[model samples]
Target: MNDETSGKASIRRELLASRALLTSRDVEDAAAALAASALELPELAGARTVAAYVSVGREPGTRALLDTLRARGVRVLLPVLLPDNDLDWAAYAGPEHLAPAGRGLREPDGPRLGPAAVLDADAVLLPGLAVDGRGMRLGRGGGSYDRVLARLAAAGRHPALVVLLYGNEVVARVPEEPHDHPVDAVVTPAGTRRFG
Candidate 1:
């Protein structure tokens, strides 16, 4: 791997390790706080549709946020992992509509709306390990969300790209590559930080 790639890998490992240390109670509290903070963002408050994902393991939780958005009469789209690592989306009906998927992910059990469904969103809540001061995000290296960003760009869809993370996950820098896309903001347990 090149320097940038290796650097991202190292940072990702550190972030994941820190997350692994979080207790279930810690995760729960953070989830609630994150949702509250995220809900305050104008991007979400005015959004008619949001593309989001279900949190698994120790990743910053998004369940509360997703439910609240749905409750507000906003169209919430949840991703379904395709075999090739690209994401297909489905409407979020409720907790009972979720089913287990590969990689310990929970996906909406509704009809697959295809990958391009994300273009309908006014905002997208991304899952990430970290986002730098420059708004560049460090994902799990799966390239799924990368494709989502690319698809949005190709279609001229500029949804508000937001990441849900813990307070500590906002760092000074994140190793970036040419294909990497910067987010519009990050919503952490503490609050939201917007970027250009």
Candidate 2:
């Protein structure tokens, strides 16, 4: 494997290993802080709709950010894994519909919508194992987000792509494959920083 892919592999391993030592609450706290910082960005102001992930594995929580966005009248959409490994979406009207989904991820319930609907979001908060300054993202061996996001980008209808990570998760560079997608920004507990 090339340096980029190797770097991403190392980061993913580190994150997965670290998750064993972290409580759910700890991830939630860090996620809340990171999302708050992202929301503070001027480019993020007044967004009508946002798409967030149901962080599973070592990814951080987006619950706090969802609540805050709802308070501001911003609609939120969460991913639902489709039978074909494509991502479907649904509105997170409130916490009432949320339940634990596969892989220990909690997502909003309701009907599953198409990828086009998710692409309509003003911003998309991505769940990644690690991210590089170039906006390349490393996910949990699934290409769902990468494929969906890449399609959106190719169509020029993509929302701003932001990866949520712990501060330590940021690396000098990440491994890139022809199919990997690049995020627009990375948000950590420290703050939101633009990537590619």
Candidate 3:
């Protein structure tokens, strides 16, 4: 399977390495604190509605930041995996609307909307196996987020794409596909940096 070859195995390996680097309690605390402070960015400060994914596997956790955001009056949106393996966007008022779902990822419990609604978000926190300084995201080979972000970009509604990762998950470069979605920034324990 060429799909399994090109970028998939590399991503899986990176995910493993990232998890190893983050196993320390210090890294976890630092990452969480940085993610929480991202909300104070001038660009994100006034954004009322924001979008984020329920992280799985080796990705850094977002639960702490999500709760902090909600407390600050920011509306949060979560992704629900649809039947075709695509994602449906829905508003998350709180934890009560979520339950265990596809691939063991948590999703919202109620109605879902189209990609257009996702694009309406002020910022999108993308989950990835690895990310490079250039802002390239390596997802789990499903292409769901790549497809969604592409559609949003094509319409000229470019939301701030941010990648959350453990500090060591940052790499020199990641293999890219023609359809891969590029993020606007990468957020790690060290700090936030803009990408091209």
> In lDDT terms, which candidate is top?
1
- Where model 2 places Cα greater than 4 Å from the true spot, the runs are 1-7
In candidate 3, stretches whose alpha carbon ends up further than 4 angstroms from where it belongs are 1-8, 17-31
Span of 10 residues, lowest total lDDT, candidate 2 = 54-63
Model 1 C-alpha lDDT versus the unseen true structure: 0.95
In model 1, the runs with Cα more than 4 Å from the true position are: none
Q: Compose the digit string of candidate 2's lDDT tens values, residues 1-196.
A: 7776676677788878976688877887887787779779654576788888766654676767777788788888888887677788898877778888776668777877777777678888888878877888888877788767776878788678888888877877777888887888888898877865
Query: Between candidates 1 and 3, which one is better according to lDDT?
Result: 1
- lDDT per residue for candidate 3 within 1-196, as digits (tens), equals 5653566676777577657655557555865766666766655677787888766554677777777778889878888887886778887767777799868888888777776787788888888767887788877777788778877888888778888776666777787767877788877777777877
Candidates in order, TM-scores: namely 0.99, 0.88, 0.87
Q: Which ten residues in a row have the lowest lDDT in candidate 1?
A: 187-196
Q: After superposition, how far is residue 65 of candidate 2 from its true place, in Å?
A: 0.1
Encode model 1's per-residue lDDT on 99-136: one tens digit a residue: 99999999999999999999999999999999999999
Q: Between which residue pairs do clashes occur in model 2?
A: 4-175, 5-175
> Of models 1 and 2, which has the larger TM-score?
1
The alpha-carbon root-mean-square deviation between model 1 and the true structure, to one decimal in Å, is 0.6
Query: How many backbone clashes are present in model 2?
Result: 2
Clashing pairs in 1: none
